[model samples]
Target: MDNAATTKITENVLKAMLPYLRENYGNASAIYSLGQKSRAAIENSRIKIAENLKVKPSEIYFTSSGSESDNWVIKETLNPREKNHIISSKIEHPAILNSLKSVERFGNETSLISVDEEGFVNLDELSEKIKDNTKLISIMFANNEIGTIEPISEISKIAREKNILFHTDAVQAMGNVKFNLKDIDVDMLSISGHKLGAPKGIGILYIKEGVEISPFINGGEQERGMRASTENIASIVGIAKAIEDAYANMDENINYTSDLRDYTIEKLLNIDGIIFNGPIDNRLPGNINITLKDTKPQTMVQYLDMYDICVSSGSACAAGSINPSHVLRAIGRSEEDSLSTLRLSINHNNTKEECDYVVEKISEGMKKFKNR
Candidate 1:
């Protein structure tokens, strides 16, 4: 049920990556024939990813992780000399919020836009906050905790009219949601391989043509000089294959998972004091975030784990901190109520039996905790 945190690497992705790890193990930057083979493979993977996103290959720049991709766009797009203002939401991942903190250290200004009770960014507030100095606007494609999808196309239109650069942290939305960059006027988007069925340590940052931005990493002239590092060849190949597999099975997977999710939500609602978070409509198909009254999220999570069922209270990045979720707080949840939240993210591979089993454990735990 914790598919949002990460997913098991599919067999096809591993099969595609093995050759790069063993037989084709060569530096992509080198000039030798073996290195050329590695370089060609990397380009092929880039092309495939671009095709999936409906963008040119030049727009895709590989990075170490989704965090780095988010950091790169923020660091590269903000010109401290003139344009100092940035706009984002309060419900963003720490990657965006923490990077904005760094941007503030350099005397740049930022506006943390607020979201509504259902975790949707307040579009009117977002438009009102934009100023002439606002060089960039970064809103995530979806909420990781509550699974509310944002209005990226509408937001992009607003940014375009204002001539501001638009970006989306799409780490959670890439494979689960269907979108094409060519149809949207956004300037940049970020994706993480591990969020789908690929391994960790690989990500993508897509920048539109004619968008002038500085380089985040400076060295070796790699990633078309926008980012500098030796490419993780195996991981890169694996991610492309993972994405390919995802799109190939997108419809079936989404329908199946969404059906299971709806069924789970219906059953879980029967538990006393169970209140669902996020809007019922326009949310991610596989995500179900809810709070149980009179029970702490950590306590329920611990009890469920003992039953060999996995779920999370909030973002995995924010795990281990004994604090209320910032995302839930942004949506007007009380601190104590936020502590009672649990995020159950189903995946395509989960079955009705698994969903029922999870709901049984959750119901049992809620009853056990309430009596105590």
Candidate 2:
């Protein structure tokens, strides 16, 4: 149920990566035939990924994770000395927010535009915030916790009109949304492999060709010198396979998960005090976040876990934190309501019977907690 947190690597993806991990083990940077084979595999995977994204092969740079990609774009894309202001939404992931905070030391200022009750960015405010010094706008394509897909194309347009660069952390939207960068003017985008059923270590940074940005990591010429460190060949192959699989079955997966999500939401909301969060109809297909009145998120999480039903209070990244979710706060949820929020992210493999079992357990927990 916690598919948003991380997905089980697809069996096909795993199999695709196995040869690279074993018989074909070679340093992609070396000059031997074995190494050349590894290099060829990496380039082939990159081409496949580029084809999936409908972008040129030269624009894609493989990174270690979405956070690194987000950080690279936030910290590297603009010159702090010249155009120093960056615009972003208040409900952005910590990867974007924390990167902005770090760049402040270099004299860059950040404007965090507030979102609406449904987690959509206030475009007027964003337009109003852009000044001569506003060099970049970095907003997420979707909210990981609340599952609200933002107005990405509109944001891209706003950035273009201002002649500023646009970047999106599309980590959560990769497999779930209809994301073809060719259709939008977004300057940069980020995606993580694990979110799409690949291994956790690989990610992609799609830098639109001609978008000028200096390299963040420098050493042993890798990622066309944009990023360093030896390539993880197996994981690269895994990501390509995972993405291919995800797109091939995307329509069916979306329909199945969307139906399961709606079913879960209906049953869960029937509980006396449950309040739905995020955009009801416009959210990510498999996401269901709700506030269970008077009940803490951790309590329900544990209660559900007892029955082998996995879910989350919020992002898996912020798993053990005691603080209220920043996303909920941005949408006007009180600290207490944020604390009581639960996220149930389903997938194609999940079924209505599973949702029913989860609902039964949740109802039992609510009653038990009410008594205590």
Top of the candidates by lDDT: 1
Off by over 4 Å in 1: none
Question: What lDDT is reached at residue 32 by model 2?
Answer: 96
Tell me the lDDT of candidate 1. Answer: 0.91
List, residue by residue over 1-372, the lDDT tens digit for candidate 2.
899989989999999999999989999999999999899999999999999889998999999999999999998988745748999989998999999999888778899999999999999999999988888999999899999999899888888877999999999998898778988769999999999899998999999999999897999799889898999999999999998888889898988888888888989889998899999867899999999888877888888888998989999989999999999999999998998888988889888898899999999888878523
Report lDDT per candidate: 0.91, 0.90
The 10-residue segment with the lowest total lDDT in model 2: 363-372
Q: Write the per-residue lDDT of candidate 1 for residues 6-64, one digit (tens) a residue.
A: 99999999999999999999999999998988899899999999998889999998998
Q: Provide TM-scores for the models.
A: 0.98, 0.98
Clashes of 2: 0
